[model samples]
Target: MAAPVITVSNKSLLHDQWQLLQPWFSYFDADGNPAVRYQLWDSGATATSGYFWTPTNAHWPANTTIDVAASDISNVWLRSGSAGGSETLWIRGFDGTDWSGWATFTFTTIPNSLPVATVEDQSLHVNQWARVSTLLSYSDANGDAATKYQFWDSGTAATSAHFWTPTNSHWAPNTTIEVSAADLANVWIQGGSTTGSETLWVRAFDGFNWGAWDTFTVASTNAKPVVAVADHSLHVNQWTRVGSWMNVSDANSDTITKYQFWDGGTAATSAYFWTPTNSHWAANTTIEVSASDIGNVWIQGGAATGTETLWVRAFDGTEWGDWDTFALTTTINTAPVATINDQSLHVNQWVKPGSWLSATDPEGDTITQYQFWDGNAAANSAYYWSSSNAHWASGIAIDVSAADLGNFWLHAGAAEGSDTMYVRAYDGTAWGNWDSFALTSTNTAPVATISNQTLNAAQWAQLVNWTAASDADGDAITKYQFWDGNAGANSAYFWTPTNSHWAAGIAIDVAAADLTSLWVQGGTAGGSDTMYLRAFDGTEWGAWHSFVVTTAV
Candidate 1:
């Protein structure tokens, strides 16, 4: 049933139901029945004591519908308590002056007649006090109830309306998606993923609840939903796979004004999302939606292991297309596609200390490559390519020529950090599985470290502890050493040094009791005395910090 546009002023009867009953005095006229008398009216109608003229009484209805006409609806009167008088009248929603036809209602039935109807301006709200006796006096021949009334929702409900519903009273797209959770992000759509070029609504969610779905149109050209989730924003990418690349538009067909996205599930509008125009995705790559088209929209990969809900629509320029269904599995934010079977810089003892990097995308996509130079530019950079011998991501190696030492770098190459590659298939389907990290040349060996040796002795014969420790060969020190100092109950280590070869190799814990060691070549003066430690490799002599024997007091 349609709700009517009827409205009532409701001003006159707002509080008029205050006094619907009045007290009365009566006696039983020798019959076994109680009598009541009311000979006066308070609207200036006076009373007389001799004659009696009163309203006829009848059995009242107990909790039933009241049938009355719309015209004479205001003529009904309701009696108050067991008193002699009644007051405070209301006529319910029947404001039309004539009680012509009939209406239905439900009311209560007391043993004696009570103040059923209050003569007022308007009808009562549902489930309010009603006059059940009024319906008894009016009806059609066939007992058919004839009245028109309605129930409505004047902007109050248990759930919020959708944005695509176009009520014009809800939030608009382009709002930031600010909701969050530890699990992967999700997006919801108003009328999520319906058939054809119809509008696809967007909102975000985890698997549990959802945010509002903002509506956006799809391309008229052949298009399908490619959904992905980010910070809080959703990305809805649409494109068709062709060869090893895709045919995509910077802007979708005439349906959406501008792409938008949400951060988490919040409807925070923004235009900062990924686009194929920024980095043309190869054909075999599965492009997820960026945070551009809808608010809080997100998509997950179907080829992987997780599942997520996403909002999206597809269009073939004019006709609505089928909604693409895929299981959503969230992944880490990947930068680009890197294709190599073996890392070029990898070293292995089994491979004679030389191994070549090998890489090949099933689609045969190539990267302008550069590798770290170990020898001189010509000695290390040329074997198959450039003027000098070089190694690519394949099973190729350069002989450790004499010209390579102290000369290596992470040099610039033919690709940038944001480049992406696609995989081609025999079935005309594009594969979006590989993204690579930016590559540059890095160093060859570890840097060096050194320390200042501090030797203390209780007597010139027995050394206490030393503090000077440093590494010239700067790969984190893996070993350490303690010379001259005895290992016993009195021995205590002084300062701590990084782990090193001397520290990591021939190093032994010292106890103060082993003071009988007598290898100090004579240290009465500030002359260089030999400690058991040998210089690192003896090739580059490490600068020594000498310790002097103090004057004996």
Candidate 2:
């Protein structure tokens, strides 16, 4: 009879299920009968006795009908345990009296299945720490209560992995772990020098061997600090309270430690360094900068006028951020001070006193206006007179008349008889303090004397030295008038002065016609003639005096 055909359904099973007969078979008995019985055993001689099949009861009755209609064998046995690897199952079937040689089938028993591993991507910044392993997952299909896992970088051995369970120790499936910076650094440094994109690889290992490596990119992210100033414009020598704000952030949540300041593209180290009170680097933080600080760093640094640039940067202990820039303009506005070049003036004089008024501004500002006062008075006071509102306004002409001096004569109480004139300047902003000087006014009249002289009646002799005049105020005697005893009768006989007499240096002259008129008025050439002489200054005339004139015999 043909050996009963035997067919096993599954060729492989887990070693843990070795005690149960999971394999199924189908066949017909050699006696043409449907009844059959079977047994299973290891085919390899080196195989352990555990691979031998054992029956709880004696081998089943040979006539037990192996139902052909049923597709599988139910009670095939392996009382002995099973080992993982290729194994052979030896089976024999029998009908009541006839025996069939054993039919052999080969199958494999697998060890505990390899643990499956997966990892997640991550992002971090320089000097920042994170748990990379927490992003990993592991699983085992064998249902092995104890499955071990280890972490490793790409191109690295599991023996030298970042972290692993103790030797011979195992962890349950789906276990989680946190990979530290030091643990990652063991294979590769995270966040290579710059701040951008990067990648990391991780792999897992079961207790016996390592699984395939899995890759997850680690994005290295870092951002620069943004900075700005409250005020971009400032004045030299002006004290201003300035503030600064900053926006700083890191992907890894790093803390900002300090700040640096820059002036004109150079670091403001040494005495110019500014320290902040608030350790927290954030927006709207008040950075108190005194006016003195501006003067020392900007104004004193030769940025007296125009705009200058300033820069700021933030430090996160390990790295320095990009520099943020701002602008600062320096300005100057100082009032001008004026002084009278000529300290004294003469009253009744049309003087260019304004030419004597000098002014200066510390900021080199142009003098736009000037005001003058007759006496010592504060500028912008009711009594002050506004001069020309033009550039160099202090250089205009001014008249210190007797009326002007007289007004101050009592107010000044000058023993030397002098009035004070005050002047101040304006440089488009405010007026300066008044500067003063003294002025003198006088009304002293000239004294005159008569000199005797003879003149020929018909011969026409010229009269000499008819009169002399002098004034203490250095005023010129402009004219002279003379008359005989009958002043109204000898009106025509009066001497008329010329241009030479109008000068302060020359004396008045008497013409020949005046001599003839004088002689005729005298009634006779031989008789002495009486002439009245007087001098006139530009403003007033002197007292009259009489002089004698004689005709030659």
| RMSD list, candidates in order | 26.5, 40.5
Off by over 4 Å in 1: 1-244, 247-465, 480-546, 550-553
Per-prediction TM-score: 0.21, 0.31
List per-prediction Cα lDDT, in the order shown: 0.26, 0.47
lDDT, residue 203, candidate 1? 37
Give the C-alpha lDDT of model 1.
Answer: 0.26
How good is model 2 by TM-score? Answer: 0.31
Give Cα distance to truth, residue 120, candidate 1, Å: 38
Regions of candidate 2 where Cα sits further than 4 Å from its true position:
1-5, 13-23, 27-37, 45-85, 94-101, 109-127, 132-146, 149-205, 209-310, 317-322, 328-553
The local lDDT score (0 to 100) that residue 368 gets in candidate 2 is 57
Worst 10 residues of 2 by lDDT: 407-416
